[model samples]
Target: MAGKKRSFGRVRKLPSGRYQARYLGADGVDRPAPHTFRTKRDADDWLAERQAELRAGDWSDPDAGKIPFGTYAATWITERGIGASTADLYRSLLRNHLDPTFGTVAVADITSARVRAWRVARLDAGAGPSTVAKSYALLRAVLMTAVDDRLIRRNPCRVKGASSAVTPERPTATVQEVYAIADAIQPRYRALVLLAAFSGLRWGELIGLRRRDLDLTANTLRVRRNIAELHSGKRLIKEPKSAAGKRTVAIPAVILSDLSAHLTVFAEHGADGGVFIGAKGAAPRRNHFNRLWRKACHQAGIKGLHFHDLRHTGNTLAAATGASTRELMTRMGHSTARAALIYQHATAERERLIGNAVSAAVEQARKQAPGPNGHAAGT
Candidate 1:
């Protein structure tokens, strides 16, 4: 007897009780898909659903699988066109840390367990908690993109308590310590340190400063651009991180006076009339500043002082002077009040003074009142 003619394209029965449907795709191309069912009716139903999905352009092959997490992340990074330095750092983190652990893994396959394991491995390899946390954040960002692309149903890295590692505190230098270090710096760079401490400019902002940006009349400096050294052995001027970062900061009179003296005596006078040029009248490279800053710190007998710490010192001192959180945030160009609070929190001594005043008031009130023993005299 002749077998019944199959109506819904060619079909093959597998030993595992699954039906394979081979049909011409919407593109008029041949395609095959598999569905497991207990009976021919169920298999036909599954095939019908798949055909509807294909007709609606919503069909996805179960076997097509997701792109590897690392590949998808790389594409996302390139498409977003992050700054060169940021791109380099992300790629380095991915290649050195992430790729090795999860490069071959599909975006859909990532789970909380996998992320936890990656974090533990990084920690075991002596990676700092902050570094691990950053790596995890990058990974999570990649997974989030995967979800957005519909490559994955959800981000697996959003597990609760995933980033609970204790991050080490960033070191900060006191005002006096910073002053001593500034004193030890070569006379030419004294103003640079002072600018960093008083004006709260980042290292790049200070280096990228132009003579025009300094309004000696107004005692202000406009942070228009930042100089960064590319791996290509050249310096590049880039815009500030945000619109707020490209603001004019009023310099303290002392720092303003010092900057005036430096401009008169030592500034190399760049072609663009930059203020902080090197010996050859070009922007000072980070290497030169790094070496000079370390030597100055060493001579001043100050340990753990970083160039960026001067910015923090400025913020701390400003906060100590009762600068409102909003004022400090504006001055520091902080994107959030949370970061500004870190600087405010650094003013422990000022907070302690308030605590002492409260204590003194309590003591005076207690002395003026009768004690539990009904003594009216001062105790």
Candidate 2:
């Protein structure tokens, strides 16, 4: 007797004694199973799973994820509407780290095991922790988009703690070292070094400063723009990273005269003129400044200090002044309290002062408290 008709798909015997399954998809196209099965029952079982997926609304076009990962990632980056500098960074990460592994692979073909292996290989190859973290984050972000697009069921970047990198502690410079570097550096950059250290202005903010942004009379420096210099020597001037980044920061009283001198002697002309510039009337480049920084450090007898250390020192010093977390966040141009809390370390000197104050408060309370019989406690 003839068998009962199948419901969703057709199973046919191949010439090699294998069974192939073909099914009509939601798109009204007949799609063959990717591989042949040894038995007709197995082929029917595979088709049954596809039918179940369709019924549950989890069915996706198998060909949709056939696009190469590199192609999808490039399109993803372009459609992200990110800033130029950020685009540059993502491109660099893709080119240097991710593309070599998954470039030609189909988006759906990437597996969690492959991702883990790739990360382990990168770590074994001596890639910096931060670089690896950034790359892994980028990979995960791209794969997540694929999942959203329904090109893949899930992201394969499932490694725990792979996106966070543990960077070593950054070194900070002292007041004496700051002055020594300032004096040792060229005359034009003297104010720049001192202002960076005291005002805690980032390199981009300092470079983007204009004459109109400074009001020495009020001892406040306005941060309106940030100049980012890419690795290719291209400069992009954009708004601050966050709303808090565009704020008015108090300039240290000691550096007011130096800033005045810098404006008069080195700064460009007009109210919109640049505040900090190179010796040849050009914007300061990071590479050029690094050479000058090295010489300055040598002359100052300071070692292992980065220019950012100056800002770190300033933040730490601000915290030392008993500045509240809100105050520190405002001064540091950070939108989050966690970023500010990192600088709020209690030094031994500050701890001692706090202890002394607490002890004094206790003594005063003891002296003023009423005794059991209504006499003063101390008496």
Per-model lDDT: 0.76, 0.92
Report lDDT (Cα) of residue 337, candidate 1: 88
Assess every candidate by TM-score. Answer: 0.77, 0.94
TM-score of 2: 0.94
lDDT of 2 by residue, 28-130 (tens): 9999999999998899899999999999988889899999999999999999999989989999999988999999999999999999999999999999999
- Model 1 lDDT per residue over 58-163, tens place: 6554433467878887887898778887876788788888999889987777887888787888889998777777778788887777666656656778656555
Model 1 segments beyond 4 Å from truth?
1-58, 63-66, 106-112, 161-166, 231-234, 346-348, 352-379
Candidate whose TM-score is highest: 2
Please count the clashing residue pairs in each candidate, in the order shown: 0, 0
Q: In model 2, what are the clashing residue pairs, if there are any?
A: none
Measured on C-alpha atoms, candidate 1 has an lDDT of 0.76
